[model samples]
Target: MSTKKHKVLVANRGEIAIRIIQACVSLGLDFVCVYTRADEASGHLALARSLGGPNAAYRVSSYHDANEILAVADHAGATAVHPGYGFFAEDFRFARRVAERERSLIFIGPSWRIIRSLGDKINTKRLARSLSIPTVPGSDRPVYDELEAEEIAETLFAFQAEQGISNSVVLVKASAGGGGMGIEEIYDIEQFKTVYRRIRNYAKRQFHDEGVLIEQRIFDFNHLEVQIVADRTGTGIVHFGTRNCTIQSTGRQKRVEIAPGFRPQEVDYAFDAEKLMEDIVGYSLAMAREVGYDNVGTWEWIVSPTGQPFLMEVNTRIQVENGVSAAISRVRGQGGVNIIAEQIRLGLGEPMGYDQSNITFDGVGIEYRIIAEDPANRFTPWVGRIDQFLAPTLPYASLHTHIPMDEPYEIPTEYDPNLALAIVWGKDLAEAKKRGVDYLDELTLSGADGTGTELKSNVRFLRDKTSTILQF
Candidate 1:
């Protein structure tokens, strides 16, 4: 294949946009970036302008809807559309529109139909069960009333005949929700009824979708995940190792995230988690094969103390930690600089040499999502000009910092609070933790005293160390 330059239009904003622009530059492709009026002076737009020459950068006049973004892609004459990990990235309808709008405007992800299938919680649970994937015990469909929930519980009991679950604690989750919303635990059927009603009302008021899901709750578990990449050519699959995210202590207090969260807290039960990762990767590969999933995706799972890992959900596009995944993919020589590069190549009809021999380096990699939140006030989002900023340092490892050195960084109230990502690779888990700690300690954010540690207790470092110095 000739290495001809292709113009890529990123359909999102923020640090991820800059990351995609860099990837385009690395692969000798022109980048066309679009942003709202609010983001005209944002770091992402600034970086995009700096990367591409005149007439290559495109800025939209207004923020209408997903279709407006797609229209920008069409006007720019972009060969491919990358949704970047938020907004319409996982929206199946949006993907279908991109596919049908233009032949060359590849969606850069799994097909629209497959995305919609997995988009619904009910359908996803069914698919997981059929593939022998361990999913949280939940209602088969949306429960509209208390009696229907009871009936669903009876069916769940029948399904749980082999396992001993007498006092079942359930969680009411939304059928079409994510980002930690629409999930509440219930200790009794009455509580489940109440929580379900609350969730249903919230969903109706917010999403205009009154769908509710009930599932058994797993307590004191480690939030773990596995990432998988596949293609339509039936080339084998790739697993980008695993990550341990056990530091989400979101009760009434705030805490700093330490690697290994709590030493020996789950050491006696980690084997079960390893097995769960294997199963998750296997299930993801099977699902991809079943529906012809191409490009990159991830399967998330939660592991209990008993070593049982249950699939939580799946993300259909590049994730917040795409930097780490991209590094792994590149070290293995599987694709270009980023997952989008690989997706573009696959969409343009290129051969995928999915060889294990291509993947290199077996070190530990970890990412810390630096958000603009105040720990004292329940981790509320901090928005303003970043008057001062200093990135952390990494030793004995490769460091990838996403924040630009511009005098002012934009923090808007219309979106997520994740400001930047600090990805580091170390010789071992403990060493990786040390590097992470040292790196976090050097961050000097302005419009604030130092790093907000309210959510420090919820911060996970993925190491076995109990305590580490992180003085910023």
Candidate 2:
């Protein structure tokens, strides 16, 4: 319970690492950060060194190497490990090791058991169904048997047909696959078997598991998430609200996220937006309490075009979009809520001093994940040198980036070139959109690849999506 004695080792890199360091500082705690050779120029390492005193940043061979991470943690005398999204963020085994090791370090996330239980999409669906929580209409478990898989596919197609959904589509994906891998869509029931076999084969070859998940792919659904935070005891669970993550790349990677999920006052929707948001928040809290979720987590939900909200899965770690939710959230009539700091504090065995009623939301907040990628080319990674990276100087807007602004930074090819996160807030949704576009317009981000090719980014794509956000 004594957080001051804790020295956290940030087991990840990039802007998230910086966020974790800052969160630790805000909590009056020491911290260490690690990076690979390719990430030497990252701002996270620089900030950690500047703020974390001597030997704050450690050089590692690979971020995914648990032994290296643990060694660094031991060398730096770290008492806790914060896997800031990606890498070992959702890996239950990693979390377990951080807890069960002889010289254990606190895992700054949900417990290992909770991560393992909720990490399985199929298991999460079953849990939701048991609680009468709505999940996407699909087979809960892996359809390993061909006959059984085809029957589930036919039933899904028939169910969609009865719902008056046109151009019916069924998703056949490796149940064990993740990050949009080993998945394909089938429009024809006859073609379902072929696609299923191909995916099953791909799953076996790739994941060594031929388990396939068949589900009705609901078109025009908005990808939403509920941000849940709990105390170390899991007895206190409060929500920071929901986010609209429908603006994504063709690869299903999120590019833009907005808090509050929907704005029924500004844009009209098919279903009751406020009611839907409340329902998702309630369901998320219910599940979190059910599992004794003792830290920060995100409950992803997909709402169909007709307004049915279905639980997608649970992220047992702090999410990248968490900052957007914090931007608009206020507690005890005070603003400037830093969710990362809250997660660190709560993860380090802190008590939830305040109740849900003490927390209040202010204005609309929009977060733009500015990355060096060609959105026109299916979001191809744009690797090059960043020459001039300028951020907007607006009071309502804040940006987080690992690429330094004073000097040219070569966008490392070994990792994703996510340049920055531009978060803009406004008193209302319309104002937020205006400020978001203005922030993008004012942003001076220019770079070139090795061949002198101009950097292609999702700035334009993000700008365009600002006008149509939450309009489902």
Q: Estimate, for each residue in 1-472, the C-alpha lDDT of model 1 and write its tens digit.
A: 3434567788778877777787778777776888877676667777776777556556676443766776777777777777877677788988888887645477777767877877666777788888888888777677767678766655554544446766566677766667666667665555655777788888788677877777777766666656666665646566665555554324211122222222232234345444555566677677767766666776767777766768777777776665555543444543334556666566545666655457553445566666666554556666655566677444443333334566655555676556666676555556666776676666666653245422221123322222331210
- State which candidate has the highest lDDT: 2
What C-alpha lDDT does candidate 1 achieve relative to the native structure? 0.62
Summing lDDT over every window of 10 consecutive residues in candidate 2, give the lowest-scoring window: 175-184
For each candidate, what is the lDDT?
Answer: 0.62, 0.91
Q: Estimate the TM-score of every prediction.
A: 0.83, 0.95
Taking all chains together, the TM-score of candidate 2 against the true structure is 0.95
What C-alpha lDDT does candidate 2 achieve relative to the native structure?
0.91
List ranges where model 2 is wrong by over 4 Å: 143-148, 176-182, 197-210
Residue lDDT tens for model 2, 186-285:
9978897789889999999977899999988878889999999999897999999999999988878888999989988889998888999999999999
